[model samples]
Target: MLHLRAVCPPEQTDQAIELLRAHAGTAHLIVHRGAAVAPEGDLIEVDLAREAADEVVDSLCALRLDRTGGITLEALDTALSDAADAAEEAAPGEGADAVVWQELLGRTGEESRWNATFQAFLVIACLLAAVGVITDSPVTVVGAMVVGPEFGPLAALAVGAVLRRWDLLRQAAAALAVGFPVAMVFTGAIVLLGDAVGVFDTAAIVGNHEVDFVYQVGEASFVVALLAGAAGMLAMTSAKSAALVGVFISVTTVPAAGYAMVAAVAGSWDRAGYSILQLFVNLVGIVLAAAIVLILRRRKQRSGDLLRPLSRG
Candidate 1:
């Protein structure tokens, strides 16, 4: 279930009421006329089922309330009322399968931005992976994998492609285009400095096989990347955050970047090239898999799954 809070202009109050009053999934409705001080309108609230949210929100958007006033939505972890149960039962589809496009676009827009905090986390992850690869530590590589924030933009890219949003596509592209190279340059500089001081060498990279998988790109690497991408997208759309950690650990994006920079510092261009290829493979796999899932989800949501109750019947 979801709680929808909408501020309606005085002129549109009756229309908004007329809309929600007729929806079967509206378990509860409250109207406070002239209560919106800032917006100078009425405050309308509705407890609606998750499956019916997209339909209702679209209707609300059609009224231009999103521009004139505002609408906010929040998911209810638990609803004990019989009215709520009836609303859920009355809705067309399962709550778990609902794909609220507005919510997704909002979330991915934020995630796709290149910010200081995101940069810090990526650089930190790269540094960690650099150390891990040099020491042949799989544990440290996994730690790096968990810390990387690369998936945010990748998922955003997938969303943009499916939704045909050019702005989102550009935002995600700029983030990845600038962010990875910056991090790699920083990592590479650090590695070269460490080598000059006799703190690092090519011997470690050439002989290290324990964490060699970070650089070796093959069929298995692409398959793992695809699986992780699909899982990550499903988790995002369904609001299942716990599954995201597994996605992070399953893909080798961060580790590949680390290996690429570290190998370049050791003057192993061949290995560095391969490491970059590994990174590309993971990224392409994730985007491709996620885009396919989003297409299928949008189709399902737009098909015969939606049901509308007769107005005021």
Candidate 2:
């Protein structure tokens, strides 16, 4: 369920109230006239199911409430009232599977930005991957994957493709276009510094078959990437963020990039080519899987049969 808070002008208040009343999914509607000081309008609050949230928000936006007033929707984590139950029952689909397109747009838009913290995590993760490749340590590789923040932009890119949002596509593209090269260059420089300090040597980087998995491209890598991509889409669309960690570890994106950087630094064009190919395969698989999921989900939502309530089970 979702908790919606709205501020509406005096003239629009009645129409807004009527809209809520007409929808069986809304409950416990409350109104306070002339209560808002900033926009100076009536304050209205209601609880509605996730399945109905998109339509309601769109209808409200049609009134230009988002421009003149405000409309906010938040998850109703623990709705103790029976009215909440009735609201969910009245809605078309289950909360978990509902798309809530507006929320998704807002989330992806914010996450796709190429901000300072994003670059820091990207660089640090790549550096860690470089260390893992040089030391032949799978633990360090996993740690790098966990620390990498690359998934956000990837997911945003998929979301953008689904929604046809050019801004989101542009932001996600820029993040990847700039982020990976920068991380690789920085990791290469770090490798040089480590070699100077006797921390990394050519032999340590060469004979490590254990870490060689990062560069090897084959059917298994593609399969794993596809599964991880689907799981990642689920994590982003639903409230199951715990699965995101699994998505991070399952895909070899960061590790591959790191290994490619190390291979390039050592002037091993063959190994570098393999690593780059692996990275490319994983990236294409993930993006394709995510885009497919989003497209199917959007279709299901449109058909009004996407999410089934727990009670229906």
Candidate 3:
């Protein structure tokens, strides 16, 4: 459900209220009038049904309340007395399935900006991967995976493609274009330093069959990427974020990128190529899968019939 707050000028208040009241779903409405507020008009609070949230939000967007005055919308989770019975009756068919594309797209827009925190995370992730390669510690490798913030941009890319948001697409592509090369270069520098200190040798880095195998592309890599993409989308859209840990582990972005840096430092072009290939495969799979998921989810919502109001007993 959503709780919407709209504060507008005195003249426009009635129009806005009417538009909100006429929204597609059942809504409990409250109105407050105040003069001190800059808007100096009306403040409305609406508790709307969950099933009709998307349509309600769409309608609100159409009203362009922000341009008219000051409008803020917040989703409320508190159960209203009047809504409890209706919720109980509707619970059975309220499957976990919900189209979250719009929400996901909205969130991506909110978080896609390049900031200091993003830069710090990227640097730290690369450094961790470099250390892991030098030490050959799988634990450090996992740490790098957890620390890597590349997923945000990757997710933004998929969301942008699905929504056809050019701004998001540009931002996401820029992040990737700038981030990966920088990380790889930093990792390469660390490898060079480690070699100088006798902490790592070219032969030790390349001879590790396990690391080599990670770089080799196969059908299973595609499957893992696809599954990880779907899981990632679900994690981002749903309230459950713990599921993202599993998705992160399944994707080879950090591992492959780490391996590539190690191979480059060791002057092993074949391994570097393989690692790059793996990275490419995983990226392609995730984007394609996310796009498909969004399309299908939207289709389901469009096809489902809306629930009717219950009669009083």
TM-score of each: 0.95, 0.93, 0.85
Best by the TM-score measure: 1
Clashes of each: 0, 0, 0
* Clash list (residue pairs), candidate 1: none
- After superposition on all C-alphas, the RMSD of every candidate to the true structure, in Å, is 1.7, 3.1, 3.4
Please identify which of the two predictions, 1 or 3, would achieve the higher TM-score against the true structure: 1
- State residue 212's C-alpha deviation in candidate 2, in Å: 1.5
lDDT string, candidate 3, 215-276, tens digits: 87899999989998888876776555588788776777877887888888888888889889
Per-residue alpha-carbon lDDT of model 2 for 1-313, expressed as tens digits?
8899999998999999988877777888999999998899999999988777888898899999998899998987788889889878878767788788888889878887898888889999999998888887899999999999988888888998888999999999899889888988888888888777887874466764688899989999999999999999888887676899999998889999999888887888789899999999998889889999999988988777434332322
Which residue pairs overlap in candidate 2's backbone? none
Off by over 4 Å in 1: 305-313
Ranked candidates, highest lDDT first: 1, 2, 3
186-247 in candidate 1: lDDT tens per residue? 99899888888988774588864889989989999999998999999988888576899999
- Candidate 3 regions exceeding 4 Å error are 18-28, 35-41, 70-95, 100-102, 305-313
If both were scored by lDDT, which would come out higher, candidate 1 or candidate 2? 1
